[model samples]
Target: MRVINFAHGDMMVWGMYLAWLLATRLGIDPYLGFVGCAAALFVVGLVVQRGLVDRIVDAPHEMQILLMLGVALVLENGALLAFGPEPQRVRSALTLSTFWLGPLFVDVARLVTFAVAVALSLALYLFLFGTDLGRTIRAAADNAYGALVIGADVRRVYAVAFGIGAACVGAAGALVSPFLPFQPSAGLAASVTSFNIVIIGGMGSLLGAFVGGLLVSVAESLGAVFLAPSLKELVSFSLLILILLFRPAGLFGRRAG
Candidate 1:
């Protein structure tokens, strides 16, 4: 499903809102409520893929980009209307709990978030490499025509791929909701950050994306510690520029044949 989802961050914002809703209205913790968010976004992905993306699957790249941009706009505005412009943060007991490790205090919320992220990444890796559906998805991504030749339902594969991607985003939103304050306008920043991570890691490579995210996070942390906190983003952008110049294919992405 080689689709560039410009709406990814907006979808994540929706997931945050959903988790917030559950927590405030239903008393479900964001940690456990993330499952519901993921499931809901999975359906959203299916609807967007089938209703909008499928209509222009073969269109030019410009059309695809515009379509996604349009989707992003819609999601952002919808969120603003529904959630208002106030930044929201989910309150969690885990976020308040902390433990001392040596001389430093460790945040339980951050630790849990890291563990969940790693687990999800591993699960995604296993699914892609070990399951038939995952393999089919990879094949379709590599060559849609070849997949179709082998009697695969390429459209369905695309739908599932998109759904899974959205689910991942939703889960991520819920996971970070405990600490990150978010609003509709935050989606743009999140989208940019995501692009920086993907580009630094290597597009089309899950390992690259995972490593890239870690690298970016580490770099930002170092930047904030060594320089100014406000300059952290500058460091990330500088790294992105270097990667683009030296390894345009990305750290793990294959070079174009």
Candidate 2:
């Protein structure tokens, strides 16, 4: 999830950055560019599921891996052709400014990202706990066969839930785009981060995702201040290794095969 977040932001934001830069350099308001990129990727994510994910659901894990690797190949090469083989960054709204918050100083952009992440997490929690659809989703994720036996339309649930996960990263992408520079092939790194978050939080637990995202964010934040910024990735997964070594069931996840 973290990696996906990074890739989404890189493409969405990096793409937006380039578009805005080229246009503004030629004299245009970058807000228009930002909106255009955001809308485009929202549509792309929606289409990605409709086109790609739909075909991969029942495939073996290895097949899924092959499909994703192929998709990455096409996407990266296509981007290189379209956007060129250079990395680029924009003047981010997420500057290195600190805000005093009742005894803690916070990075403004990080703070906003955390706030948005938390709100989304809360919304997801309420969806699972408070809504019928959310209940169905949980049931389906917990046991697809049982859900189907209970007449819950398991396939549709899978489609919708996968769509939601993908879309979550899409929205995150838009939010992060104005904050980071991006390269065409950055999704690989983003995918790593997403996997780290998923592993740390415990799979199949929404609340874990919330807490896990926050923990990763805080760790990365503190790590960069005291250690090398480049080591954040190692810090994240190393912590994950230690946690899983002891907990195995994730910090909050139920144990399952």
Top-scoring candidate (TM-score):
1
Off by over 4 Å in 2: 1-46, 90-107
Least accurate 10 contiguous residues by lDDT in model 2: 1-10
User: 143 in model 1: Cα distance from truth in Å?
Assistant: 1.3
Residue 81's lDDT within candidate 2 is: 79
Instruction: Determine the backbone clash count of candidate 1.
Output: 0
Worst 10 residues of 1 by lDDT: 248-257
Residue 220 of model 1: what lDDT? 91
lDDT of 1 at 120: 94
Q: Model 1: what TM-score?
A: 0.98
Clashing pairs in 1: none
Per-residue lDDT, model 1, residue 221, is: 93
Per-residue alpha-carbon lDDT of candidate 1 for residues 1-257, written as tens digits (9 for 90 to 100): 56788888998999999999999999999999999999999999999999999999998888988999899999999999998999999987797999999999899998998999899999999999999999999999888999999999999999999999999999999999999999998887787888899888888899999999999999999999999999999899999999999999889988732
Return the clash pairs for model 2, or none: 1-194, 2-193, 2-194, 3-190, 3-191, 3-193, 3-194, 4-190, 13-177
